[model samples]
Target: YAGTGAQRVPLPTYAFQHEWFWLAPGVRPADATASGLGRVDHPVLTAVARIGDRDEWLLTGRLSIDAQPWTRDHIVFGMVLVPGAALVEMALTAGREAGCPVLDELVIESPLLLDEDATVQVQVTVGAAGEDGRREVAVFTRPERVDDDEPGEATCHGRGWLAPEGEPVTAPPGQWPPAGAEPIDVDELYRRVNKHAHLTDAGFDYGPAFRAVRSAWQVGDDVCTELELPDVAGSAQGFGVHPALLDSALHGGLGMLYRPGSEGGLPFSWSGVRLERTGSTRLRVRVGLADETALRLEISGEDGTPLARVARMDVRPVEQAQLEAARRSGRRSLHQIDWVDVPAGTPTSARVAVLGELSVPGDRYADLAGLEQAVADGAAVPEVVVTAVETAAEAGDPAERARATALSALTLVQRWLDSESLGEARLMVVTRNAVAVRDEAPELAQAPVWGLVHSAQTEHPGRFTLIDYDGGGVPDWGALLDLEEPQVAVREGRLLAPRLGRAVVGEPPTVDTGGAVLVTGGTGGLGALFARHLVERHGVKRLVLVSRRGPAAAGVGELVADLEARGAEVRVAACDVADRHRLTALFESLEGPLSGVVHAA
Candidate 1:
């Protein structure tokens, strides 16, 4: 009776869409603090300490526009930011050394920006004083990497409360530019703030030393303005005011209440400030209008007296996709490679030598002046030299013979990282199936010698090792010199290495989000953390990066303004992907086709 028309129609319920395609992580942020060191007299704090017995303190500092060049004159939508009134004068010098000197509110979450050849560090902290003496503070910042070994990722950028006092310094009440007002051309208000800082997210550029206003008026719902600072905008004495004349003392409330194509907003919150003067290079501003999203500031000194007062500042809607997701929020720094598990060892005696194409089996050495004539015929400086990397076998165009075997192992590791008696020897390099473990596909003429020796092991760290074997004998210089992992991988004979690991995924992510993604190790720091784990966790919308110091490296303009403020479509490309004719003319100047390809150079 079960014969003809296949019975079980109820079986259709198991189509299994429980999904989670996994594969995308490492965003990198982590930190704690400790290093403050001593002496701090201010002028942008240098160190203050205290945070361990709990009444909290911290402080620490550094800022760069090349050591304060008026912080490259403010900028705004064109980037250089940092001014929410320099975090309300660094929370009024960390609330006057935690005795709380009154800020009563700072809030401006994130928008530090900086990066014109970066320097940032900044800290602040404060906290623990409550019982009505107030304290809380916060500030934080980062970008100071001088080749981090561990410890970075700060961020925060302003937090509030410091009390123990309240507002007072008012002044600014009419006459000086009021009588009938109207005058405000301010060079057509800075050409409508550089034509909407080039169209939207409410733009602004202002560089003639932040065009410090100079003369402005209006006078209906108020807007005064005067400022000054420029004479090449240099010394604001030692700032308690000069954050480019208090960011042009709040751009006269964006030209007296948003106009040049409206939709403007930024300086998010200040409430009852009150400074009293610290180096005013000719001030006077004003503003007024407290509703419709706040603003009532007041600065003084073009003789009307007073110095600074806020009562309220507020302003939110910041968009550039919310300051590029708050500058790629917590800028994850990840470094993954992962393999681990090599334990089960044996051999150890060493003096290995093998450098470059003398067929790389072992005791070979045809260059480095025949190993410096067998160490001046006394030999023994070989604690391990290895090298080899000559793939593209059976080739002639296996990517131009793997770019001439990675430019002859990048000219012998730049002559073994410029000798100095081979600084306690290490070198290694060797290769063959050139790394691809876990569901493989590597040997494409030896995977560009592991992407040109991982950018020469990321600019020489512990002098290079990177093995890769899986065969043609001889790598047991006493079990590979008892192993150490600067990227290993032997396999089948046992010994893997690499390690960074941590990516578990739980569900949600089908991904494709269209093309573009080249990468190739260029925007420094592991190519902007694998292009910010492919534009914030694999929604990847086009990249390119590649490096040979493109855009003259060193945080290539803050990693292309943090992956084009996270909406992606970046490009960087300095090209030298080992140079197969400038990596095939940078992939025929790509503007299309590239669903993926990271090879991290």
Candidate 2:
């Protein structure tokens, strides 16, 4: 019995039932409380969680064209890509959550492409504190819908370490513009660069976006440039430092590297990258040589605020064929030759002119001489003149040697064609391995001869013939000489001739707005023309135009705006297609599988 008073009441004997109940696996009630950590709300990021008993945190998010419309603005080689600066911002955000406010270094290994309509989950993982009290950070992303039987593999975009905020390093004294720098003509620079690309086949064709270098100058050993974002690319302000802007800043250094007849170089690697600001639309960059092969860049904002610094950057030259190969799948196809079967014809009674060395073993000199002898014996008049020009042995530098040999052979043929003694003679140039099809270095050295001779063929018509013979054995000169084709090849006792085929026009493939068509080098003259064609003719609604410049290219804004008015959506990206990791990441980021790719770049 219990006494019933104002503070005490009579209690009935009953035990409260407390039994275990099922809760969601890996979730606890404390996870619902937002006491220790806050939530992250970003178009690219979804939530943040901390791992108990470990100094680590994970931030998860998704990227899609709808959630981050501006992401579609960054197109590289026809794929919608997330800018590298955005990755840096995400890492910085994660760093801030872990009490580390500084990014010591971050290297973007691959680009992040946004899917057209679907979402790609992203995870920013911050690991336990390091010996230096900094946390290791990594960024990974995967497709949302993967096959049930296939395990989803996340793509790692980058990895680096973040450190606690420390004393800021003193930057250069605030100066509007450095003194003693000679101004560079921006228009002329682009003109020359574009011209070089066209002539040398280097494959770099910057439209408006990649033309980030507004003004530049050379002061002593330093190359200084003023870079500004294009008006259409104002959305870049959301990034930590826009890739196009940063890439353009580096373009200023190109003025220093440009030579009259050499291939242009691109950034190969970056080290010790440090960013101090969130957005920088305008920058004044100063690049100096770190050593013989690397560069050091110091960057600042419009008001002289230090923005970023790179201790070292290595730049390397690239070839056009290499870039093209990287953009396509499967083996690189060789130039197709339309083979012609020339009917056997009676030997011409007229004199034939032959040029190039026939003295070396395996040279077709004996066969050619036999034909000349047979013609002389059969007819009263000498039917052919077998003139042999000895090929010079490779001497001095290999390139110079090849050039010298080619020029020597060309001079002989030109003199023969111009001479009255050889009037009305059908000229034929012959060589062994001179038309280099395998060795690119030798090809580069010998290409001019082929170019000149091919032009002469078009101008002179039936008077000129060029033949490449295998140096392993003698060729069948009788059969080759009887053929009417201007270009022929003799390999392993067989004769091949170049034949022209009518150009065939086929119906364009069907495409819909749900998928995308990527046009590499999309900002160029031809790319723009095709983009318009795809929109108007093929009914393509989504077009991704990729170039080194992307939207920053000159006239790109107008082009994009015009396309938009025409009911076509265009996204521009500034990326190097030759970068395998970036290219793979870009492909994975697409909304759906690409409808088609026009590899103009």
Candidate 3:
């Protein structure tokens, strides 16, 4: 199949041959033990032995929650997962048996998810040595079972090469901290990075576990950074290299990769990788450009010992699909807020101040103006005086403008708190649709302002009241102002107090058990719990779980299998509910009409 003039090299004979040979019947059992390393003791591995020659080895084991309790701490997108680093460790350990101490590279193809009720059998196989003295290694796993008739086939998760310890990399020259590097203000860095809500938009929303870039600096054409994993993630201790630690190491170059007011980037490929140490929580990293579009990184322990090196790393701009996937899969339950009600108190006769213009052309604006008129009429307090504060809309691009507006509102509130214009009367901060809701048009980009006000409310205690009024027709100021609830939504002229004892329970609504019930934020912890509840208690037979990752999410295969075993038809759809076009297309493609929707997202 080659071109007419193209030259081709003949293939060499296979380096290692695989032929089973049975031992003589007269051989002693003790001789078998002498031929191998015997038994291996590890939390996730067992039955280690050599095969063929010293260049080849085999390791078989099993993994379960009971055997590795710490795995539960490394959750991603609501699923307990076997960290990619764990697979690297297994490969390295197998290589060590074959006299290889360094890993060349490992490519992760699929995530290995641990099942809650089933033990998974693991196999790490290292092939015979090649000409260059490197051995090929592969890691595979399947569900453990007692029956031989239906043993589950193993799935390979990753493959790589290993070799004898390579030459030690020279440590950075001279004293620590490297001379002539200017320190970068970390606080401002995070502020600018988060300016456009980049964390959520770029799918890089990291919690304390992954926020390991402690500090950074810029040298001539090089970016230097210091990183350390959170103490709560525990010690890196026995790990060959903690995934979170390594992942954070890549983030150290974000300052160089990210362009202000542009799309963010993520690591796309790696080459010539090597790990020289194990269990390093703190590291120093130096990243330099490999060429026009790639980076060269050198990493060392905090004490200047060489640890790892990457010859080249290609970073690609993050696409919208990836951002949407991350936004849907990342933890949403952590940010859930529980609004507390304002305590009962008589209205003080101080001036009623409106922080911004409440006279726009809409039903919500009309309701706000009506409420203002009611305050002027002294509906709840005696002798009401009204004051209006003029505020400007944020200036600049969308992201910058949003931030500026938020800061302006906050500055005004701070000034009001410091002013001595009037005697102490409870200050009420009112805005329309200040609380952000999924799939809704945001109001005045005031969500960030609301966040600041909540913090101030906690510090000032009893001195300020925050109200988020849903825009609609005329508001019942008489009843709304009389209610002790501080945070509430006025919908259709009705005052609804959130998180207050104002809820009314009625008879349970009828649900079609035979019809499909759609659950948004499906594949999430809460969504999974609700799905089970629907299947067991409500007798729901068909369920649809919708999220950005859908069936590709880790642990989804086991989850679907379990649900199917229980006689429930489960369908996972990678649809963004916020995107109307995509959501409509999803509904159109469904086998049947949706009977109900649980908006748990």
Per-residue error for 279 in candidate 1, Å, reads: 16
Error of model 2, residue 134, in angstroms? 3.0
lDDT (0 to 1) per candidate: 0.71, 0.64, 0.64
Q: Which stretches of candidate 3 lie over 4 Å from their true place?
A: 1-47, 52-54, 60-89, 113-120, 144-153, 165-167, 185-199, 202-204, 258-269, 291-294, 315-601
TM-score of each: 0.28, 0.42, 0.43
Poorly placed runs, candidate 1 (over 4 Å): 1-57, 60-83, 91-122, 125-153, 156-177, 182-222, 225-251, 256-298, 301-303, 306-324, 327-512, 521-574, 577-588, 593-599
lDDT of 2 by residue, 260-339 (tens): 56555545545556667766678888887776556678888878878777776665564443433333321111224465
Q: Pick the candidate with the highest lDDT.
A: 1
RMSD of each: 27.6, 32.1, 22.1
lDDT digits (tens) for residues 293-363 of candidate 1: 67777788888888878888877666675665564553333444578767644665666787656344357
Quote the lDDT for 487 in model 2: 71
Q: How far is 298's C-alpha from truth in model 3 (Å)?
A: 1.8
Alpha carbon lDDT at 297, candidate 2: 80
Tens digits of per-residue lDDT for model 3, 1-601: 6668877897664532222244322111233246455655444555677775465688877776555554565444445556565776677767766788676776665566664545677889988889898888889987666556356677787787887766456577465567898887766555554553265454445556666788987788787788887654445644566666776676656555555665555454455666777778889988877865567788899988898887776655545543334333321221233344344335443334432355322123122335445545654431222222222354646666567767766775676576443225455566567674323565555666667777877887765556566667655444444455545655445554555233232334457986899999878888888888888778888999998899897778887787788789999999889999999999988897688899877
**In model 1, where is the ten-residue run with the lowest total lDDT?**
23-32
Q: For residue 327, what is the lDDT in candidate 2?
A: 30
Best-fitting candidate, measured by TM-score?
3
lDDT assessment of candidate 2: 0.64
